[model samples]
Target: MSTTALSSSSTGSTGQPPPRRKAPRRPKPAPGTQRISPLRVIGLTVVWLFTAFNLLVLYWLIMAAFKTPLEIFREPLSLPATLFERGTPFRNFVYAWESAEFGTAFLNTVILVAVCSVVIVLVSAPAAYALSRLGVRGSGPMTAFIAIGMGVPFQTVIIPLFIAMSEIDLNNNLFGLALIYVALSLPFTVFLLTGFFRSLPDELEEAASIDGASATRTFWSIMLPLARGGLITALILNAIGLWNETLLAIVFLQENANFTLARALFTFYNAASYQSEYGGLLAGVAIIVLPMLVMYILLARRIITGLTLGAGK
Candidate 1:
Protein backbone atom coordinates (compact mmCIF):
# COMPACT_ATOMS: atom_id res chain seq x y z
CA MET A 1 0.00 0.00 0.00
CA SER A 2 2.88 2.47 0.98
CA THR A 3 4.82 1.67 -2.27
CA THR A 4 1.69 2.15 -4.36
CA ALA A 5 0.92 5.54 -2.73
CA LEU A 6 4.53 6.79 -3.20
CA SER A 7 4.55 5.76 -6.89
CA SER A 8 1.15 7.41 -7.48
CA SER A 9 2.31 10.73 -5.86
CA SER A 10 5.53 10.76 -7.91
CA THR A 11 3.56 10.16 -11.15
CA GLY A 12 1.12 12.98 -10.26
CA SER A 13 4.03 15.41 -9.64
CA THR A 14 5.69 14.48 -12.93
CA GLY A 15 2.46 14.99 -14.85
CA GLN A 16 1.79 18.41 -13.16
CA PRO A 17 4.52 20.40 -15.01
CA PRO A 18 7.49 20.47 -17.35
CA PRO A 19 10.45 22.96 -17.31
CA ARG A 20 10.37 25.80 -19.91
CA ARG A 21 13.04 25.86 -22.65
CA LYS A 22 15.21 28.97 -23.16
CA ALA A 23 15.55 30.43 -26.68
CA PRO A 24 18.80 29.93 -28.61
CA ARG A 25 21.25 32.88 -28.42
CA ARG A 26 21.92 34.95 -31.48
CA PRO A 27 25.55 35.61 -32.44
CA LYS A 28 26.76 39.20 -32.04
CA PRO A 29 27.66 41.22 -35.12
CA ALA A 30 31.36 41.05 -36.01
CA PRO A 31 33.55 43.92 -34.96
CA GLY A 32 33.95 46.69 -37.65
CA THR A 33 30.97 45.23 -39.54
CA GLN A 34 28.11 47.48 -38.30
CA ARG A 35 29.98 50.53 -37.02
CA ILE A 36 29.42 54.01 -38.44
CA SER A 37 32.52 56.14 -38.24
CA PRO A 38 32.32 59.83 -37.29
CA LEU A 39 34.09 60.87 -40.46
CA ARG A 40 31.51 59.18 -42.64
CA VAL A 41 28.63 60.69 -40.66
CA ILE A 42 30.16 64.15 -40.95
CA GLY A 43 30.81 63.76 -44.66
CA LEU A 44 27.23 62.64 -45.27
CA THR A 45 25.88 65.54 -43.24
CA VAL A 46 27.90 68.04 -45.28
CA VAL A 47 26.70 66.52 -48.55
CA TRP A 48 23.08 66.69 -47.38
CA LEU A 49 23.48 70.33 -46.38
CA PHE A 50 24.92 71.29 -49.77
CA THR A 51 22.21 69.36 -51.60
CA ALA A 52 19.51 71.10 -49.57
CA PHE A 53 21.02 74.51 -50.23
CA ASN A 54 21.10 73.95 -53.99
CA LEU A 55 17.53 72.67 -53.98
CA LEU A 56 16.38 75.73 -52.07
CA VAL A 57 18.11 77.99 -54.58
CA LEU A 58 16.45 76.17 -57.46
CA TYR A 59 13.07 76.51 -55.79
CA TRP A 60 13.60 80.22 -55.24
CA LEU A 61 14.54 80.76 -58.87
CA ILE A 62 11.50 78.89 -60.14
CA MET A 63 9.18 80.75 -57.80
CA ALA A 64 10.70 84.14 -58.53
CA ALA A 65 10.39 83.60 -62.27
CA PHE A 66 6.61 83.84 -62.09
CA LYS A 67 6.53 86.82 -59.74
CA THR A 68 6.35 90.46 -60.79
CA PRO A 69 9.08 92.96 -59.92
CA LEU A 70 6.92 94.19 -57.02
CA GLU A 71 6.17 90.66 -55.80
CA ILE A 72 9.81 89.62 -56.11
CA PHE A 73 10.98 92.60 -54.06
CA ARG A 74 8.15 92.21 -51.55
CA GLU A 75 8.46 88.46 -51.03
CA PRO A 76 11.83 87.47 -52.32
CA LEU A 77 11.81 84.00 -50.85
CA SER A 78 8.10 83.38 -50.42
CA LEU A 79 6.00 80.93 -52.43
CA PRO A 80 3.77 82.17 -55.23
CA ALA A 81 0.40 83.62 -54.09
CA THR A 82 -1.39 81.35 -56.58
CA LEU A 83 -0.36 78.94 -59.36
CA PHE A 84 -1.97 81.11 -62.03
CA GLU A 85 -0.23 84.32 -60.96
CA ARG A 86 1.54 85.06 -64.22
CA GLY A 87 2.54 88.60 -63.14
CA THR A 88 3.86 89.41 -66.60
CA PRO A 89 6.28 86.44 -66.68
CA PHE A 90 5.08 85.35 -70.10
CA ARG A 91 5.03 88.93 -71.35
CA ASN A 92 8.58 89.43 -70.11
CA PHE A 93 9.69 86.23 -71.88
CA VAL A 94 8.06 87.44 -75.09
CA TYR A 95 9.77 90.83 -74.76
CA ALA A 96 13.09 89.24 -73.92
CA TRP A 97 12.77 86.89 -76.88
CA GLU A 98 12.01 89.69 -79.36
CA SER A 99 14.48 92.13 -77.79
CA ALA A 100 17.45 89.81 -78.42
CA GLU A 101 16.20 87.83 -81.43
CA PHE A 102 16.67 84.75 -79.25
CA GLY A 103 15.23 82.53 -82.00
CA THR A 104 18.19 83.37 -84.22
CA ALA A 105 20.53 83.01 -81.26
CA PHE A 106 19.09 79.57 -80.54
CA LEU A 107 19.47 78.50 -84.16
CA ASN A 108 23.06 79.79 -84.27
CA THR A 109 23.95 78.06 -80.99
CA VAL A 110 22.48 74.76 -82.24
CA ILE A 111 24.38 74.95 -85.52
CA LEU A 112 27.61 75.95 -83.79
CA VAL A 113 27.35 73.12 -81.25
CA ALA A 114 26.53 70.52 -83.91
CA VAL A 115 29.29 71.57 -86.30
CA CYS A 116 31.92 71.84 -83.58
CA SER A 117 31.03 68.45 -82.07
CA VAL A 118 31.23 66.75 -85.49
CA VAL A 119 34.55 68.41 -86.31
CA ILE A 120 36.03 67.50 -82.93
CA VAL A 121 34.91 63.88 -83.27
CA LEU A 122 36.26 63.60 -86.82
CA VAL A 123 39.61 65.21 -86.04
CA SER A 124 40.31 63.92 -82.55
CA ALA A 125 39.21 60.26 -82.96
CA PRO A 126 41.69 59.48 -85.77
CA ALA A 127 44.48 61.38 -84.07
CA ALA A 128 43.83 59.51 -80.85
CA TYR A 129 43.56 56.18 -82.72
CA ALA A 130 46.91 56.68 -84.43
CA LEU A 131 48.56 57.72 -81.18
CA SER A 132 47.20 54.68 -79.39
CA ARG A 133 47.46 51.87 -82.02
CA LEU A 134 49.39 52.83 -85.16
CA GLY A 135 52.92 52.74 -83.64
CA VAL A 136 53.70 55.79 -85.75
CA ARG A 137 56.94 57.69 -85.19
CA GLY A 138 56.56 61.04 -83.31
CA SER A 139 53.25 59.91 -81.77
CA GLY A 140 54.56 60.51 -78.28
CA PRO A 141 55.87 63.92 -79.19
CA MET A 142 52.60 64.83 -80.89
CA THR A 143 50.57 63.70 -77.86
CA ALA A 144 52.82 65.63 -75.54
CA PHE A 145 52.37 68.73 -77.69
CA ILE A 146 48.60 68.41 -77.47
CA ALA A 147 48.75 67.80 -73.69
CA ILE A 148 50.88 70.94 -73.33
CA GLY A 149 48.22 72.96 -75.08
CA MET A 150 45.69 71.89 -72.41
CA GLY A 151 47.73 73.64 -69.72
CA VAL A 152 47.69 76.95 -71.63
CA PRO A 153 44.78 79.25 -70.70
CA PHE A 154 42.44 80.68 -73.34
CA GLN A 155 43.07 84.18 -71.94
CA THR A 156 46.70 83.83 -72.99
CA VAL A 157 45.77 83.15 -76.60
CA ILE A 158 42.70 85.39 -76.97
CA ILE A 159 44.58 88.39 -78.41
CA PRO A 160 46.44 86.37 -81.00
CA LEU A 161 43.26 84.44 -81.84
CA PHE A 162 41.36 87.65 -82.27
CA ILE A 163 44.04 89.11 -84.58
CA ALA A 164 44.11 85.95 -86.67
CA MET A 165 40.32 85.87 -86.91
CA SER A 166 40.22 89.52 -87.91
CA GLU A 167 42.87 88.98 -90.55
CA ILE A 168 40.91 86.05 -92.02
CA ASP A 169 37.57 87.92 -91.77
CA LEU A 170 36.33 85.15 -89.50
CA ASN A 171 35.47 87.38 -86.54
CA ASN A 172 31.79 88.02 -85.67
CA ASN A 173 30.66 84.90 -87.58
CA LEU A 174 29.07 81.70 -86.23
CA PHE A 175 31.46 79.68 -88.43
CA GLY A 176 34.38 81.37 -86.70
CA LEU A 177 32.92 80.52 -83.26
CA ALA A 178 32.43 76.91 -84.34
CA LEU A 179 36.06 76.70 -85.52
CA ILE A 180 37.29 78.14 -82.24
CA TYR A 181 35.18 75.67 -80.23
CA VAL A 182 36.57 72.72 -82.22
CA ALA A 183 40.14 73.81 -81.62
CA LEU A 184 39.50 74.42 -77.92
CA SER A 185 37.91 70.98 -77.46
CA LEU A 186 40.57 69.04 -79.44
CA PRO A 187 43.32 68.56 -76.84
CA PHE A 188 41.19 67.08 -74.08
CA THR A 189 39.02 65.11 -76.52
CA VAL A 190 42.12 63.50 -78.07
CA PHE A 191 43.58 62.77 -74.67
CA LEU A 192 40.39 61.08 -73.44
CA LEU A 193 39.86 59.13 -76.71
CA THR A 194 43.45 57.92 -76.72
CA GLY A 195 43.02 56.51 -73.24
CA PHE A 196 39.84 54.72 -74.35
CA PHE A 197 41.40 53.46 -77.59
CA ARG A 198 44.46 52.12 -75.82
CA SER A 199 42.22 50.17 -73.44
CA LEU A 200 40.63 48.19 -76.35
CA PRO A 201 41.88 44.63 -77.06
CA ASP A 202 44.49 44.40 -79.80
CA GLU A 203 43.30 40.83 -80.50
CA LEU A 204 40.11 42.21 -82.07
CA GLU A 205 42.14 44.16 -84.63
CA GLU A 206 44.37 41.16 -85.24
CA ALA A 207 41.34 38.94 -85.92
CA ALA A 208 39.98 41.48 -88.38
CA SER A 209 43.32 41.61 -90.18
CA ILE A 210 43.38 37.79 -90.42
CA ASP A 211 39.91 38.02 -91.99
CA GLY A 212 41.48 40.10 -94.82
CA ALA A 213 40.28 43.46 -93.54
CA SER A 214 42.69 46.31 -94.34
CA ALA A 215 43.72 48.83 -91.66
CA THR A 216 41.05 51.37 -92.66
CA ARG A 217 38.44 48.66 -92.97
CA THR A 218 39.35 47.21 -89.56
CA PHE A 219 39.07 50.63 -87.94
CA TRP A 220 35.82 51.55 -89.63
CA SER A 221 34.07 48.21 -89.15
CA ILE A 222 35.35 46.96 -85.79
CA MET A 223 37.17 49.69 -83.88
CA LEU A 224 34.77 52.55 -84.51
CA PRO A 225 31.74 50.49 -83.48
CA LEU A 226 33.53 49.45 -80.30
CA ALA A 227 34.38 53.09 -79.60
CA ARG A 228 30.80 54.35 -80.01
CA GLY A 229 30.27 54.83 -76.27
CA GLY A 230 33.42 56.93 -75.98
CA LEU A 231 32.41 58.93 -79.06
CA ILE A 232 28.98 59.68 -77.55
CA THR A 233 30.62 60.78 -74.31
CA ALA A 234 32.90 63.10 -76.25
CA LEU A 235 29.99 64.49 -78.23
CA ILE A 236 27.94 65.23 -75.09
CA LEU A 237 30.89 66.84 -73.31
CA ASN A 238 31.84 68.98 -76.29
CA ALA A 239 28.21 70.02 -76.76
CA ILE A 240 27.96 71.18 -73.15
CA GLY A 241 31.22 73.11 -73.41
CA LEU A 242 30.13 74.80 -76.63
CA TRP A 243 26.70 75.63 -75.23
CA ASN A 244 27.99 77.29 -72.05
CA GLU A 245 30.84 79.13 -73.76
CA THR A 246 30.61 82.81 -72.83
CA LEU A 247 33.93 84.67 -72.95
CA LEU A 248 34.79 83.76 -76.52
CA ALA A 249 31.24 84.43 -77.67
CA ILE A 250 31.28 87.79 -75.93
CA VAL A 251 34.60 88.82 -77.41
CA PHE A 252 34.01 87.55 -80.94
CA LEU A 253 30.34 88.44 -81.29
CA GLN A 254 30.32 92.23 -80.93
CA GLU A 255 27.08 92.88 -82.77
CA ASN A 256 23.99 92.97 -80.52
CA ALA A 257 22.05 90.86 -83.00
CA ASN A 258 24.81 88.20 -83.16
CA PHE A 259 25.04 87.90 -79.36
CA THR A 260 24.39 84.47 -77.90
CA LEU A 261 21.82 83.94 -75.14
CA ALA A 262 24.56 84.17 -72.53
CA ARG A 263 25.58 87.63 -73.75
CA ALA A 264 21.96 88.66 -74.23
CA LEU A 265 21.36 88.07 -70.53
CA PHE A 266 23.66 91.02 -69.88
CA THR A 267 21.23 93.39 -71.59
CA PHE A 268 18.81 92.83 -68.68
CA TYR A 269 20.86 95.22 -66.57
CA ASN A 270 21.85 98.31 -68.53
CA ALA A 271 23.72 100.84 -66.41
CA ALA A 272 21.59 103.56 -67.94
CA SER A 273 18.26 101.81 -67.18
CA TYR A 274 18.98 101.72 -63.41
CA GLN A 275 16.06 99.29 -62.94
CA SER A 276 17.07 95.65 -63.46
CA GLU A 277 14.34 93.20 -64.47
CA TYR A 278 15.16 90.47 -61.99
CA GLY A 279 12.09 88.33 -62.70
CA GLY A 280 12.70 88.27 -66.44
CA LEU A 281 16.39 87.53 -65.93
CA LEU A 282 15.67 84.61 -63.65
CA ALA A 283 13.04 83.27 -66.07
CA GLY A 284 15.46 83.57 -68.94
CA VAL A 285 18.11 81.70 -66.96
CA ALA A 286 15.62 78.94 -66.16
CA ILE A 287 14.81 78.67 -69.85
CA ILE A 288 18.46 78.49 -70.81
CA VAL A 289 19.24 75.73 -68.28
CA LEU A 290 16.10 73.64 -68.97
CA PRO A 291 17.46 71.98 -72.12
CA MET A 292 20.65 70.90 -70.39
CA LEU A 293 18.67 69.51 -67.46
CA VAL A 294 16.43 67.57 -69.85
CA MET A 295 19.40 66.17 -71.74
CA TYR A 296 21.10 65.11 -68.53
CA ILE A 297 17.96 63.39 -67.29
CA LEU A 298 17.46 61.58 -70.61
CA LEU A 299 21.06 60.46 -71.13
CA ALA A 300 22.21 60.13 -67.53
CA ARG A 301 22.29 56.34 -67.53
CA ARG A 302 24.11 56.08 -70.84
CA ILE A 303 26.57 58.76 -69.77
CA ILE A 304 27.32 56.92 -66.55
CA THR A 305 27.80 53.58 -68.29
CA GLY A 306 30.00 55.02 -71.03
CA LEU A 307 32.14 56.95 -68.59
CA THR A 308 32.52 53.90 -66.37
CA LEU A 309 33.50 51.69 -69.32
CA GLY A 310 35.95 54.28 -70.62
CA ALA A 311 37.52 54.76 -67.19
CA GLY A 312 37.57 51.09 -66.13
CA LYS A 313 40.48 50.06 -68.31
Candidate 2:
Protein backbone atom coordinates (compact mmCIF):
# COMPACT_ATOMS: atom_id res chain seq x y z
CA MET A 1 0.00 0.00 0.00
CA SER A 2 1.12 3.62 -0.58
CA THR A 3 2.41 5.46 2.58
CA THR A 4 -0.17 8.30 2.10
CA ALA A 5 -3.09 5.86 1.98
CA LEU A 6 -1.86 3.93 5.06
CA SER A 7 -1.39 7.22 7.02
CA SER A 8 -4.93 8.48 6.08
CA SER A 9 -6.57 5.16 7.08
CA SER A 10 -4.76 5.09 10.47
CA THR A 11 -5.82 8.71 11.25
CA GLY A 12 -9.50 8.00 10.32
CA SER A 13 -12.53 10.48 10.51
CA THR A 14 -11.03 13.54 8.93
CA GLY A 15 -12.77 16.82 9.95
CA GLN A 16 -16.45 15.81 9.42
CA PRO A 17 -18.86 16.87 12.23
CA PRO A 18 -20.24 13.70 13.81
CA PRO A 19 -23.53 13.00 12.04
CA ARG A 20 -26.18 15.08 13.85
CA ARG A 21 -28.06 12.91 16.39
CA LYS A 22 -31.74 12.56 15.51
CA ALA A 23 -33.82 14.40 18.11
CA PRO A 24 -36.60 12.33 19.71
CA ARG A 25 -39.62 12.77 17.48
CA ARG A 26 -42.32 14.63 19.36
CA PRO A 27 -45.86 13.33 18.93
CA LYS A 28 -47.47 15.69 16.44
CA PRO A 29 -50.89 17.10 17.34
CA ALA A 30 -53.58 15.14 15.51
CA PRO A 31 -54.95 17.92 13.31
CA GLY A 32 -55.65 21.33 14.69
CA THR A 33 -55.26 23.04 17.96
CA GLN A 34 -52.44 24.57 19.97
CA ARG A 35 -54.96 26.01 22.49
CA ILE A 36 -57.93 24.67 24.50
CA SER A 37 -61.37 25.44 23.08
CA PRO A 38 -63.35 28.31 24.63
CA LEU A 39 -66.44 26.12 24.86
CA ARG A 40 -64.54 23.49 26.85
CA VAL A 41 -63.26 26.16 29.24
CA ILE A 42 -66.78 27.54 29.66
CA GLY A 43 -68.17 24.07 30.35
CA LEU A 44 -65.57 23.45 33.08
CA THR A 45 -66.32 26.85 34.66
CA VAL A 46 -70.03 26.12 34.74
CA VAL A 47 -69.46 22.73 36.40
CA TRP A 48 -67.23 24.30 39.07
CA LEU A 49 -69.80 27.07 39.70
CA PHE A 50 -72.58 24.51 40.08
CA THR A 51 -70.45 22.49 42.53
CA ALA A 52 -69.72 25.64 44.58
CA PHE A 53 -73.43 26.54 44.68
CA ASN A 54 -74.39 23.09 45.99
CA LEU A 55 -71.69 23.27 48.68
CA LEU A 56 -72.97 26.68 49.73
CA VAL A 57 -76.54 25.41 49.94
CA LEU A 58 -75.46 22.46 52.08
CA TYR A 59 -73.52 24.79 54.40
CA TRP A 60 -76.55 27.08 54.73
CA LEU A 61 -78.87 24.18 55.53
CA ILE A 62 -76.50 22.85 58.20
CA MET A 63 -76.22 26.32 59.80
CA ALA A 64 -79.98 26.77 59.64
CA ALA A 65 -80.40 23.64 61.76
CA PHE A 66 -78.95 25.60 64.73
CA LYS A 67 -80.87 28.81 64.10
CA THR A 68 -84.38 29.77 65.26
CA PRO A 69 -87.38 30.34 62.96
CA LEU A 70 -87.00 34.12 62.99
CA GLU A 71 -83.22 33.97 62.59
CA ILE A 72 -83.57 31.66 59.62
CA PHE A 73 -85.47 34.46 57.83
CA ARG A 74 -84.16 37.71 59.35
CA GLU A 75 -80.49 36.74 59.41
CA PRO A 76 -80.47 33.73 57.13
CA LEU A 77 -76.76 33.90 56.36
CA SER A 78 -75.53 34.66 59.90
CA LEU A 79 -73.79 32.15 62.15
CA PRO A 80 -75.45 31.05 65.40
CA ALA A 81 -75.64 33.96 67.88
CA THR A 82 -74.12 31.92 70.67
CA LEU A 83 -72.93 28.36 71.18
CA PHE A 84 -73.91 28.29 74.91
CA GLU A 85 -77.65 28.95 74.87
CA ARG A 86 -79.69 27.48 77.72
CA GLY A 87 -81.65 24.17 77.48
CA THR A 88 -80.61 23.08 73.98
CA PRO A 89 -79.16 25.19 71.19
CA PHE A 90 -80.53 22.69 68.69
CA ARG A 91 -84.12 22.95 69.94
CA ASN A 92 -85.28 23.05 66.33
CA PHE A 93 -84.10 19.45 65.95
CA VAL A 94 -86.02 18.43 69.06
CA TYR A 95 -89.17 20.35 68.06
CA ALA A 96 -89.15 18.79 64.60
CA TRP A 97 -88.53 15.38 66.07
CA GLU A 98 -91.45 15.53 68.48
CA SER A 99 -94.05 17.56 66.57
CA ALA A 100 -93.60 15.71 63.27
CA GLU A 101 -93.69 12.35 65.09
CA PHE A 102 -90.27 11.85 63.58
CA GLY A 103 -89.18 10.12 66.77
CA THR A 104 -91.47 7.19 65.93
CA ALA A 105 -90.54 7.39 62.26
CA PHE A 106 -86.89 7.27 63.19
CA LEU A 107 -87.39 4.13 65.27
CA ASN A 108 -89.41 2.48 62.53
CA THR A 109 -86.85 3.41 59.89
CA VAL A 110 -83.98 2.15 62.00
CA ILE A 111 -85.77 -1.15 62.47
CA LEU A 112 -86.54 -1.49 58.78
CA VAL A 113 -83.02 -0.55 57.62
CA ALA A 114 -81.20 -2.72 60.12
CA VAL A 115 -83.40 -5.77 59.73
CA CYS A 116 -83.70 -5.65 55.96
CA SER A 117 -80.00 -4.89 55.38
CA VAL A 118 -78.93 -7.83 57.55
CA VAL A 119 -81.41 -10.18 55.94
CA ILE A 120 -80.34 -9.17 52.42
CA VAL A 121 -76.64 -9.74 53.12
CA LEU A 122 -77.35 -13.10 54.77
CA VAL A 123 -79.64 -14.26 51.99
CA SER A 124 -77.60 -12.88 49.07
CA ALA A 125 -74.19 -14.12 50.19
CA PRO A 126 -75.17 -17.80 50.18
CA ALA A 127 -77.08 -17.50 46.95
CA ALA A 128 -74.17 -15.67 45.31
CA TYR A 129 -71.75 -18.35 46.50
CA ALA A 130 -73.95 -21.04 45.03
CA LEU A 131 -74.28 -19.26 41.71
CA SER A 132 -70.65 -18.24 41.34
CA ARG A 133 -68.66 -21.08 42.87
CA LEU A 134 -70.76 -24.21 43.34
CA GLY A 135 -71.23 -24.77 39.58
CA VAL A 136 -74.75 -26.02 40.12
CA ARG A 137 -76.89 -26.75 37.05
CA GLY A 138 -78.92 -23.82 35.71
CA SER A 139 -77.08 -21.39 38.01
CA GLY A 140 -76.29 -19.10 35.06
CA PRO A 141 -79.93 -18.97 33.91
CA MET A 142 -81.08 -18.53 37.51
CA THR A 143 -78.68 -15.63 37.98
CA ALA A 144 -79.85 -14.00 34.75
CA PHE A 145 -83.49 -14.36 35.87
CA ILE A 146 -82.70 -12.78 39.25
CA ALA A 147 -80.82 -9.93 37.52
CA ILE A 148 -83.97 -9.09 35.52
CA GLY A 149 -85.51 -7.93 38.78
CA MET A 150 -83.01 -5.05 38.92
CA GLY A 151 -84.48 -3.63 35.74
CA VAL A 152 -88.02 -4.15 37.08
CA PRO A 153 -89.22 -0.92 38.63
CA PHE A 154 -90.56 -1.25 42.17
CA GLN A 155 -93.57 0.89 41.15
CA THR A 156 -94.77 -2.01 38.97
CA VAL A 157 -95.26 -4.35 41.93
CA ILE A 158 -96.42 -1.90 44.62
CA ILE A 159 -100.13 -2.45 44.00
CA PRO A 160 -99.81 -6.23 44.06
CA LEU A 161 -97.64 -6.13 47.19
CA PHE A 162 -100.14 -3.85 48.91
CA ILE A 163 -103.03 -6.11 47.94
CA ALA A 164 -101.19 -9.21 49.11
CA MET A 165 -100.32 -7.55 52.41
CA SER A 166 -103.93 -6.47 52.94
CA GLU A 167 -105.29 -9.96 52.26
CA ILE A 168 -102.72 -11.43 54.64
CA ASP A 169 -103.41 -8.77 57.34
CA LEU A 170 -99.79 -7.52 57.08
CA ASN A 171 -100.51 -3.97 55.87
CA ASN A 172 -98.93 -0.99 57.60
CA ASN A 173 -96.74 -3.33 59.68
CA LEU A 174 -92.98 -2.58 59.96
CA PHE A 175 -92.24 -6.28 59.46
CA GLY A 176 -94.13 -6.22 56.19
CA LEU A 177 -92.22 -3.13 55.09
CA ALA A 178 -88.97 -4.93 55.93
CA LEU A 179 -90.02 -7.95 53.90
CA ILE A 180 -90.74 -5.74 50.90
CA TYR A 181 -87.37 -4.02 51.26
CA VAL A 182 -85.66 -7.41 51.36
CA ALA A 183 -87.38 -8.57 48.17
CA LEU A 184 -86.58 -5.37 46.33
CA SER A 185 -82.97 -5.50 47.60
CA LEU A 186 -82.16 -9.09 46.60
CA PRO A 187 -81.45 -8.65 42.87
CA PHE A 188 -78.70 -6.07 43.27
CA THR A 189 -77.16 -7.83 46.24
CA VAL A 190 -77.02 -11.15 44.41
CA PHE A 191 -75.62 -9.56 41.27
CA LEU A 192 -72.99 -7.63 43.21
CA LEU A 193 -71.93 -10.52 45.46
CA THR A 194 -71.92 -13.01 42.62
CA GLY A 195 -69.40 -10.91 40.70
CA PHE A 196 -67.38 -10.30 43.84
CA PHE A 197 -67.44 -14.01 44.74
CA ARG A 198 -66.33 -14.95 41.25
CA SER A 199 -63.35 -12.60 41.57
CA LEU A 200 -62.08 -14.65 44.53
CA PRO A 201 -59.51 -17.45 44.04
CA ASP A 202 -60.95 -20.93 43.74
CA GLU A 203 -57.80 -22.25 45.40
CA LEU A 204 -59.04 -20.99 48.76
CA GLU A 205 -62.13 -23.16 48.52
CA GLU A 206 -60.07 -26.14 47.35
CA ALA A 207 -57.75 -25.72 50.34
CA ALA A 208 -60.72 -25.76 52.72
CA SER A 209 -62.13 -28.85 51.06
CA ILE A 210 -58.79 -30.67 51.15
CA ASP A 211 -58.61 -30.03 54.88
CA GLY A 212 -61.78 -32.11 55.33
CA ALA A 213 -64.10 -29.10 55.54
CA SER A 214 -67.57 -29.69 54.16
CA ALA A 215 -68.95 -27.37 51.47
CA THR A 216 -71.30 -25.78 53.98
CA ARG A 217 -68.47 -25.13 56.45
CA THR A 218 -66.18 -23.87 53.72
CA PHE A 219 -68.86 -21.42 52.61
CA TRP A 220 -69.95 -20.17 56.01
CA SER A 221 -66.55 -20.18 57.69
CA ILE A 222 -64.22 -19.46 54.75
CA MET A 223 -66.15 -17.84 51.91
CA LEU A 224 -68.46 -15.56 53.89
CA PRO A 225 -65.59 -14.09 55.90
CA LEU A 226 -63.63 -13.32 52.72
CA ALA A 227 -66.70 -11.68 51.17
CA ARG A 228 -67.17 -9.11 53.93
CA GLY A 229 -66.45 -6.10 51.70
CA GLY A 230 -69.16 -7.06 49.20
CA LEU A 231 -71.56 -8.00 52.02
CA ILE A 232 -71.04 -4.63 53.68
CA THR A 233 -71.63 -2.86 50.38
CA ALA A 234 -74.94 -4.68 49.91
CA LEU A 235 -75.90 -3.95 53.52
CA ILE A 236 -75.24 -0.24 53.16
CA LEU A 237 -77.13 -0.03 49.86
CA ASN A 238 -80.22 -1.78 51.27
CA ALA A 239 -80.13 0.30 54.45
CA ILE A 240 -80.03 3.53 52.45
CA GLY A 241 -82.88 2.36 50.22
CA LEU A 242 -85.13 1.24 53.09
CA TRP A 243 -84.32 4.35 55.09
CA ASN A 244 -85.32 6.72 52.28
CA GLU A 245 -88.22 4.63 50.96
CA THR A 246 -91.33 6.79 50.75
CA LEU A 247 -93.73 5.45 48.12
CA LEU A 248 -94.21 2.05 49.69
CA ALA A 249 -94.18 3.40 53.23
CA ILE A 250 -96.86 5.98 52.50
CA VAL A 251 -98.94 3.45 50.58
CA PHE A 252 -98.66 0.54 52.99
CA LEU A 253 -98.83 2.66 56.09
CA GLN A 254 -102.04 4.64 56.15
CA GLU A 255 -101.59 5.21 59.90
CA ASN A 256 -99.34 8.08 61.00
CA ALA A 257 -97.79 5.97 63.75
CA ASN A 258 -96.77 3.31 61.25
CA PHE A 259 -95.08 5.83 58.91
CA THR A 260 -91.38 5.52 58.09
CA LEU A 261 -89.13 8.59 58.22
CA ALA A 262 -89.51 9.18 54.49
CA ARG A 263 -93.32 9.23 54.67
CA ALA A 264 -93.10 11.37 57.81
CA LEU A 265 -90.89 13.81 55.88
CA PHE A 266 -93.54 14.02 53.16
CA THR A 267 -96.16 14.64 55.83
CA PHE A 268 -93.99 17.31 57.46
CA TYR A 269 -93.46 18.95 54.09
CA ASN A 270 -97.16 19.04 53.20
CA ALA A 271 -98.23 20.29 56.63
CA ALA A 272 -96.87 23.67 55.40
CA SER A 273 -96.82 25.32 58.81
CA TYR A 274 -93.11 24.64 58.34
CA GLN A 275 -92.60 27.91 56.46
CA SER A 276 -92.89 29.57 59.87
CA GLU A 277 -90.44 26.95 61.17
CA TYR A 278 -87.98 26.60 58.32
CA GLY A 279 -85.09 26.03 60.72
CA GLY A 280 -86.88 23.08 62.32
CA LEU A 281 -87.75 21.64 58.94
CA LEU A 282 -84.13 21.96 57.86
CA ALA A 283 -83.05 20.17 61.04
CA GLY A 284 -85.49 17.37 60.27
CA VAL A 285 -84.02 17.06 56.78
CA ALA A 286 -80.57 16.94 58.29
CA ILE A 287 -81.72 14.24 60.69
CA ILE A 288 -82.90 12.07 57.84
CA VAL A 289 -79.64 12.62 55.90
CA LEU A 290 -77.08 12.26 58.69
CA PRO A 291 -76.87 8.46 58.81
CA MET A 292 -76.26 8.18 55.09
CA LEU A 293 -73.57 10.86 55.19
CA VAL A 294 -71.87 9.09 58.07
CA MET A 295 -72.01 5.75 56.30
CA TYR A 296 -70.54 7.21 53.11
CA ILE A 297 -67.70 8.77 55.03
CA LEU A 298 -66.89 5.63 57.00
CA LEU A 299 -67.12 2.99 54.31
CA ALA A 300 -66.23 5.01 51.20
CA ARG A 301 -63.26 2.84 50.33
CA ARG A 302 -65.10 -0.45 50.76
CA ILE A 303 -68.08 0.91 48.85
CA ILE A 304 -65.97 2.11 45.94
CA THR A 305 -63.98 -1.12 45.84
CA GLY A 306 -67.03 -3.36 45.89
CA LEU A 307 -68.91 -1.41 43.24
CA THR A 308 -65.96 -1.27 40.85
CA LEU A 309 -64.58 -4.75 41.64
CA GLY A 310 -67.03 -6.36 39.25
CA ALA A 311 -66.70 -3.80 36.49
CA GLY A 312 -63.58 -5.17 34.79
CA LYS A 313 -64.43 -8.85 35.21
Best by lDDT: 2
Q: How accurate locally, in lDDT, is each candidate?
A: 0.80, 0.84
Candidate 1's residue-wise lDDT over 81-160, tens digit each?
A: 63246454375566556655677777777877888898999899988999989898999999999988889899888999
Cα displacement (Å) at residue 252, model 2: 1.0
After superposition, the stretches of candidate 2 with alpha carbons farther than 4 Å from their true spots are 1-50, 69-76, 80-88, 272-275
Question: How many residue pairs clash per model?
Answer: 0, 0
For candidate 2, list the clashing residue pairs, or say none.
none
Name the lDDT of candidate 2. 0.84
Clashes of 1: 0
Q: How many pairs in model 2 have backbone atoms within 3 A of each other, for residues 3 or more apart or on separate chains, i.e. clashes?
A: 0
